[model samples]
Target: MTPFWKLSAAGFAATAIAYGPARMGFGLFLPEFRSVFSISLQAAGFISSLGFFGFFVGLLISQFLTARRGPRPPIVLGLAAATTGMSLVAVASNLTVLSLGVLLAMLSAGFSWTPFSDAINRQVEERLRPVSLSLVSTGTGLGIVAAGAAALLMSIGGVSWRLCWALFAVGSAFALLCNWIALSGAGEASGVRRPLRWQALFRRATTPIFAIGLCYGVTSTVYISFAADRIAQAGGVPGLPANLSGSLVFICYGAFGLLGLVTGQIKTLTGLPWLLRLLLLASALSSVLIALAPASWAGVVVSAGLQGINVMMTSAVLAFWSDRLFPAFPSRGFTAVLLAVATGSVLGPVAAGSFASHFGVTAMFLATAALAASAALAIRSGYISETPHPE
Candidate 1:
């Protein structure tokens, strides 16, 4: 196989394990976790927030590592963390162990994704870089599909949820091995080690990227952390078994999320700014749909499909956009964008929990929709330039 093909496969596997089973599984399995741990809804939200905070910590470590070392080390460490973390969750006998496992698993996501920006920048031909990045991100959809399938099977077979996590751990280990081999000779940068410049992160050129990241982060993570729980609480899809209904929505999410593979073409045709605006509109629609019809099988499934596309497409846009913005240090610039994402993710669930407590989950969803709509309008008003700024 060619180098691009190899990178695509490895990057796909890396993202699949990191984002799907490791980071996203917590939300997918939140209902089970809450029941088993005897935790309240508020407590569950807090744990989700803590996991996002851990993601932030991983991003910080990865930014410096990718700058000093190469993409491979952080990528490898991230997969390893996913493997170890999922293993712990598989056998957790108490809430503390489960929380620690979740933290480590989510942290892997921060480390796993951004390094690919640097890797593609250095390894792929410039003409193929955006397509390659989109291909890599589409792995998250596949991962979600696989996890949802496993969950559906578990429900049918009366298998334990722990077994599901064990399977996730095993898959993570496989991804780790694939990335380690595929990234051979892809390590250790030759450069002066220095602190990431605050100025670079705060530049006018990057303002829209940061703002988009923050808004999308809040909207996306809140939905991920609680959507299933809300659906499950609403008694799930009418025709399906209660346990299977929630899982089915994610399968739709992953299936539609595969649409992310076409993101490069879409961006080429529509331009990045327009693409971002459309995606934010989709997100707002998704949040509002779920809030309005959490129990409707068609409604929640459609919401997941919209969210799936938004999640995958936005990730690809951010990767290439940051690469465009900071060619000399793609990972470093991407790190700043991801940090903004992580910040919003950390804030999202906590604030959402408060909203859910004071009002209801419906209120939380409506509020997130409003935030997404406001951000989309801001972009429409030319708060962000229509094209990438000149380097």
Candidate 2:
């Protein structure tokens, strides 16, 4: 394989290994943490939110660093941080220490993502960008599956959750090694340049892009934070088995990513707006089903699968639109959306957790469904337009 494809594959592997076990698995393990530590649900939510907040901080910092230094250094730093973070989590004794570990892990994950994505966008040909990115995004789903399997394995072995974390730490180290080997000699070929100003980058993206960012942030946050919990509640599954629920959620996510890969080609053959509309509608419908599904495991699985398809489709659409809108600065433009995503991620868990505490998990799912519906409408209303290009 060519170096570029190899890099993309390595990036996919790294992302799946890091985020699946570290970030998304946190939710799978949340009930355990809450039970073991005797913490309030809100406190548990805040702990997860803290990690997301760290991701936001990391992304903001990465924007400047990547613009100036290119992607390699940040990527390396991110991998190291992730390794350290997960290792710390393996031995954390208290809520505070666990939260600290989560924060660091998320920061590292965000750092890795921003620079790696920036590198991919800069290096890949325009025509192949969407499929490449969709492939990369699919890594999250793969990671989720792997984490679920790991959790199940731990359960069978009668091992503590801490040992699972140690496994993740070991896996992250391997991923880091792979990243180093793949990226070696790649950076020197591209000359280093001075970092661009954040203000200038923002000016170029305009309000529409920012709106898109905001929309994405809100929708994704809601989905990621609540999808599994909603499944547990809706399916009448107990909290102990929620990791299985998360595994189901990721299965849907991965399946939809594959769908996005197939549908992305339609955009090349037909038009962008049609595909966007289809994805938006799918998102809306999935939200509705998730909110309204009867309390059964089967319902939860179906709902999660639908929502996954919607999310993966939206991901492709966003990537395609960002490239068109900010052709000159794809990394900066994409980062703006990613920042919004991180912000939403931080807010989503807090809001859902609080609502679930006060009202119930059902109410939380309904609220998330409403937000998804609203986002779908916003995309359909023609408020957002693809930048016209010369054919």
TM-scores of all predicted structures: 0.93, 0.85
What is the alpha-carbon lDDT of model 1 when measured against the actual structure?
Answer: 0.85
Compared with the true structure, what per-residue lDDT tens digits does model 2 show for residues 206-287?
5555665565565555666556555554444445454455555655555555565665677777566556556555655665
Off by over 4 Å in 1: 123-131, 192-195, 268-273, 386-391
**Clashing residue pairs, backbone N/CA/C < 3 A, model 2:** none
User: For model 2, what is the alpha-carbon lDDT of residue 334?
Assistant: 73
Write down the lDDT of every candidate, Cα atoms only.
Answer: 0.85, 0.68
- Which one wins on TM-score? 1
- For candidate 2, what is the TM-score? 0.85
Could you tell me which 10 consecutive residues in candidate 1 have the lowest summed lDDT? 382-391
Which candidate leads in lDDT?
A: 1
